[model samples]
Target: MQTVELTVRRTVGRSLVFQTKVLEVDANRDDPTIVVACPEGLDPLEHHFDASIAWTSALGRMEYAVTTRPERRGRGRVWLLTLTGPLTGVQKREYFRADVSIPVVVSWTDGPPAVSASTNGTEPQTHRLAGVVLDLSEGGVLASVSGVPPPVGTQVQSVLRIDDDEIVHAATVVRHVSLAGGTGVALAFADPSLHGDRLRQVAFEAERKRRRGD
Candidate 1:
C-alpha cells in the first residue's frame, strides 16, 4: 500500500514529448504491469508509444522503459503501462540541474551541541552558516558562503526558499572549493526521496521560464 512519486515522460523520435506526473499510484509490487492514475488531459495518441518512468527507491534512483496498453481500467483517469525492460540504476549527476541563486542557511551537524545561554537555561545557542545557492539539482546543490566550508565529508542541514515554498534538507558536503572572498561547497541530499520531486519540479519550471524569457 506504499505509494511512490513518479516522473513519466513520453517521447517520439528525436523530439521531446509531454512530461507528466503519476498522480495516484503505488508501484511497490513486483508485478510486470502497474496501474497509474495520471492527471487529466494527458492522453497519448499512440497506444504503444515508448515511454520512460523514473522514481526514487530505497536502493537509489531507478528508471525503466514501458509501453502503454490500449486497455483502460479503474473508474477515473487511469492508464495501464507494461514494463518493457528491467529497472536501471541512475546516478546522482543524471538528475536535471538548474542554475539559480537562492538564499540558504547551512547548519553544521557536527558542530558543538546546543547549550543554554540564559541563566534560567531556557534559550539555546547554535551556529549557522549563511550562503547562497549558486546552482541546484534534485541530487544536490552548490552554495557560496561567507566562511570556510566544512570538510568534504562533513554533514550539514540546509534551509532554502524555492519560490514561495521553504525547503529543508539534510545533506553532506561532497566538494569544497575556496572562492575569492567566500567558500563554495557542494552538498548532496541525504534522503533525496523525501524532497527530490519538489526540487525537480522547481528546476524544470525554472528552465521553462528561462526559455520563455520570463
Candidate 2:
C-alpha cells in the first residue's frame, strides 16, 4: 500500500505533516497533482494554509516541495491540488489502468487502393468501423467488436464519446484477432497527447467510483 503526506506551510514557512492513504495521484498529464480524500468527520482545508505533498512510487520517494493550493472539486470529500512551482523529484513512471466500457468510432487507412481513371495524386482510401472500448490507458485501448477488425499495423483514428464530449485520437492497430464472443483488437495511440490526459482522468474517476461501490 502507498500513502500520501501533506505538509502544511504557514505564513512563517513552518510546516506540519498530515498523513493519509485515501489519495489518488493524476500524474500522467502535463500538470500533475494528488487528489486527497477528506478524512471522516474532519475538513482538511480548515487545518492548513498552503501545503506541500509527497509520496513514494516505483522510482523512489517523490516530493512536490513547492507550496500548493487546494481546490474543492467534485464532491466536498476531495481536494484538487495545484503546485505553485516545479515538482522536485525523480520521475519514475508506472502506468495504472481501469476497466471500462465505452463506444467509439474507428476510421482507418486500410482499404484497398482504387484505380482512379484521373491521375491527380490520390489519398489512401479509408474505412470506418465501430467498436466498444473494453479498457483504456494513457497509451492504448482494448476494443472488442464483431467480425474481423483491421489488420495489425493499421493506422486508425478513434473518436471516443464520453457523454457529450467527443475526444479524437490517433492510434495504430497493434493486435487484431477473433474472440469467442467477438473480435478483439489492441490499439496503441500514435501520440497520446491528443487524449492521454483526458483518458487518464477518466480512468482515475472510474477507480474512485469503484472504490466507493457507486
Candidate 3:
C-alpha cells in the first residue's frame, strides 16, 4: 500500500480528519491501514474505529458515514460522529472536509470585544465577542451580547457579510446568562464557519498552486 501526506483540512467538535491519496490499482494486497494523528485537543472516533474511517485508492478520495449523537440529557448540544466504511468509488471531492467556517458580525456597547482603558489595541483582541464568532479553529462557541445574551432558550439569526456576498442562517441561543453586567449575544450559525472555511480552503489551494508554480 502506498501512503500520501494529507494536510488537515478542517475540524469541528474536537475531531480532526485528514485524507490520504488512494493507491493506483495494480493488484490486490493487504487492506490499507491509516494512522491518524490529530492536533492537540482532538480525539479520534473511538467506538466505530475502522468503520468510521476508510478511503478508496482506485477512486482517490474518502468519505465519512456519520450519525448525530444527542448531547447530554437536555439536548443542549450534539455530537455528530461518522461511521467509516469501505470507500470503493469516491468522487466529486467538493468540500472534502466536513467542517464549516461561518461569517459573523460582532458588536459591543461597554467596550470592544475585549475590555480596555484605551483603543490602541494594546489589549488582547476579543476574537469571540458576544454575537460574534471570531475564530472557528477552536471549538464552536456562543457569544453573549447583552447580559450573557440568552440562556437555554433564545432566538437568533446569523447574518454573515463576506466581500460583496451575504448569507443568513437560523440559530438557537444555547447558554447560561448571568446578572453580571456587560454581556454580548452570540449568533449561532446553522452553517458555522461557512465563509471562513471557504476562504481558508481557497487560500490553501491557491498557495498549493503557487508552490507548484515555484
Best by lDDT: 1
Off by over 4 Å in 2: 1-94, 111-116, 120-125, 177-180
Residue 92, candidate 1: how far off, in angstroms? 8.8
Q: lDDT per residue, candidate 3, 16-133, as tens digits?
A: 3332332233233343333333212223332232224333233334555433222222322222333334444356322222222344644223323554567555443332232433
Q: What's the TM-score of every candidate structure?
A: 0.61, 0.56, 0.31
| Local distance difference test values of all predictions, in order | 0.67, 0.67, 0.37
lDDT of 1 by residue, 81-194 (tens): 677888786764456666788899888755345556754343333458989988887788999998767778877899988778779999998998766778899999987767
lDDT (C-alpha) at residue 204 in model 3:
37
Off by over 4 Å in 1: 1-31, 39-41, 44-48, 69-72, 90-101, 109-128, 134-139, 177-183, 190-197, 200-214
Q: Give candidate 2's error at residue 61 in angstroms.
A: 13
lDDT of 2 at 169: 84
Can you write out model 2's per-residue Cα lDDT over 81-154, one digit (the tens) per residue? 66665657655553345678899888877444655758654667777878888888767788887556888888
Question: Would you give me the overall lDDT of model 2?
Answer: 0.67
